[model samples]
Target: MKGPLFYAKILLFGEYGIIKDSKGLAIPYNTYQGALKKSKNLSEVSKKSNENLKKYFDYLVGLETTLVTFRLVEFKKDIEEGMYFDSSIPQGYGVGSSGALVASIYDKYADDKITVLENLTRDKLLKLKQIFSKMESFFHGKSSGLDPLNSYLSLPILINSKDNLEATGIPSQKEGKGAVFLLDSEIIGETEPMVTIFMNKMKNEGFRKMIDEDFAKYTDACIDDFLHGNMKSLFGNVKHLSKVVLDNFKPMIPTAFHKVWQKGIDSNDYYLKLCGSGGGGYILGFTENFEKTKKILKDYKLELVYRF
Candidate 1:
């Protein structure tokens, strides 16, 4: 059976700060997507995927009477018939693998939680977040619901504050020497433990202050400069953001890339940041000159996202 497809998402800016109402931006990353499908033979992972989805659907079904409603019977029947996610998105890669699955399940099963065809207003978005938080909590111990929301909407979501979000327009990429790219670590990173470490780090008043004063400032500036097409300001803020990640997010960054990450900061060639939780997986990079950054970091692969 064909089901609605949900794309992967990138939390371009914000990250941890969004939890505290810091400005944020997330964009749909179309490189990976997922859809529901039935198979004749289930691989071990597929079987596990289906089994996990059943319990998630049951949880959603249990919540239906109090919140939204859906076709639980059909959904359950579909699950019994080998329904599984056919997806290119990598799990534990910080690319919204679970988020896309959650989005697809809500689309196919939820009765009136949200409608893709309808205009998504602030109220609708909030309701969708509420439903998605419960659904996605199956993956992350706690979820902000931004990942599924971005994948489901397939739109650039701007987080103005904790409760405020809307579709936003990013500047068109210009043909230029500079580019934003993703460098794959070639290892999957689990989110929950990384987040646990972050929470533990938050207990330090000093670390908390850095997040509030330093990280938030640069992240907001990066989002603002990027969306407004202010390339000069974008690069300046990216430099600071790169340094912040290097200083505080050391544990999350893969060990091998630590030198590369620092080299960029010192040389002003390319700035790197955690793509997601960052123990491994993809690392996001910003360069004032792609040719220069590439030449400096020639050993690693890069996937360009935007140009300027």
Candidate 2:
């Protein structure tokens, strides 16, 4: 038997800035998705997935909460019967690989689960985010829960702050030269370590000031600009945000891409920023000329998200 599918997600704007109440935007990435399935004979890859499911099942069983409950007995039976998460979303690529799995499991086993078909109110959305944060924290030591929330609803989510968020609409994609894309770093990013670095930086008054004045400012403006279908303004703000990241969040950036990241801003071809927690994953990119940027970034792989 196969469970329902859950798509991957792209945090186009938020990244680390969301942790400190900066505005952020995320959209569902339909190119990659996941679902639960069972087989009588498990392949090596399936076996590994099954093993992880067993561990996650144990964690769920121990959770004490009123938010939601799982069908543990059925879940365990399925696990014993070679149930595993069959997925196409790449892990450690900052595209919500585990978040998709979390959404799928919640869809299948959680009692009183919130379906996407319902008229999702703000309170319901926040509740789901809170539950997802608790559920997804098993994978990352700390989770904002927005990843799974985006995957679960399969809608563009806008984060106004820690306590405010909503499902929002993005302007329809156009076949224009400008685009938002993903640049593969070809290196895995570990969330816990990167978050540790960010947390450490937050302690310094100077760093905190930059985040408040520069990072969050540009990030909020970029989100506002993009949502309003203002590409020109969006690019300008994204450039400023890129510079802020390069100057302050160096540890979160993969060392190899440092020059290129700066070069994107310097040459004005494309601006690259973190996709998730940075360190090494898919770096989010925005360019007014996709063809030119693609040629300049010829050695690396680029996945298009939206065209402007």
Candidate 3:
């Protein structure tokens, strides 16, 4: 048995900001995806996935939440039948690996699950977010549920704030000099530690002030500019947002890439920001000139996301 595919997601804006009820934008990244499958002969990878699912299923059974409930009996039966998640999405890369898994499980076995075909009113979206948050918490110690929500809906979600989000459209991708892309840091990022660092930083009045004044402001602007197809303004705001991240969220970035991160801002060729938690996964980049930025960062692996 095989289930439908669930794509990975990129939180284009509002990485940590969304936790504070700031605006966020998440888009589906079809480059990597996952689905549920059953096989008689399981490979080592699938075997491990199956084991992980067992633990997650057990957790769900004990979890007491009003948001949503899983059909644990059927889910367990599938696991016993050698069910595993066959996925290409890289784990610990901040690209929604576990989120895809959570979405697939909910899609297949959740009792009275909200169908993607529904009208998806604002209340419905919030409920889905709440459900997914509870379900995905088995993976991330804390979750906003936006990743699975994005994958489940397979739509661009515009988050006006924590409780306010809806499926929204982004400017059409165009073939032009400016572009958005992903830079592989070639190192896996652990979400928990990175999140812990952010929490610790929150204790500092200076850090909190910067997040409210600088980080949230620029992030909100970037989201607005991108949605309206205001490329010039988007680039300007992204530059400032990137700098704020470098200065304030330094620990979240991998140490080796500090110089490269700075060089992008210093030269104006590109600006890099955290793709997810950013201890070292894929660093998100925006370049006014794709060709030029690619040439400069030739030593790194770059994947194009959108063009302007």
Tell me, by lDDT, which candidate is best: 3
Better of 1 and 2 by lDDT: 2
Query: How much is 102 displaced in model 1, in angstroms?
Result: 0.6
Q: List, residue by residue over 113-144, the lDDT tens digit for candidate 1.
A: 67767988998888888778877887888898
Looking at candidate 3, what is the lDDT of residue 101?
93
Off by over 4 Å in 2: none
Each prediction's Cα lDDT score? Answer: 0.86, 0.93, 0.94
lDDT of 3 at 94: 86
Candidate 2 accuracy as lDDT: 0.93
Clashes of each: 2, 1, 0
Residues 161-255, candidate 2: write the lDDT tens digits. 98899899999999999999999999999888999999999999999999999998998999899999988889999999999999999998999
TM-score of each predicted structure versus truth: 0.95, 0.99, 0.99
- Residue 106 of model 1: what lDDT? 81
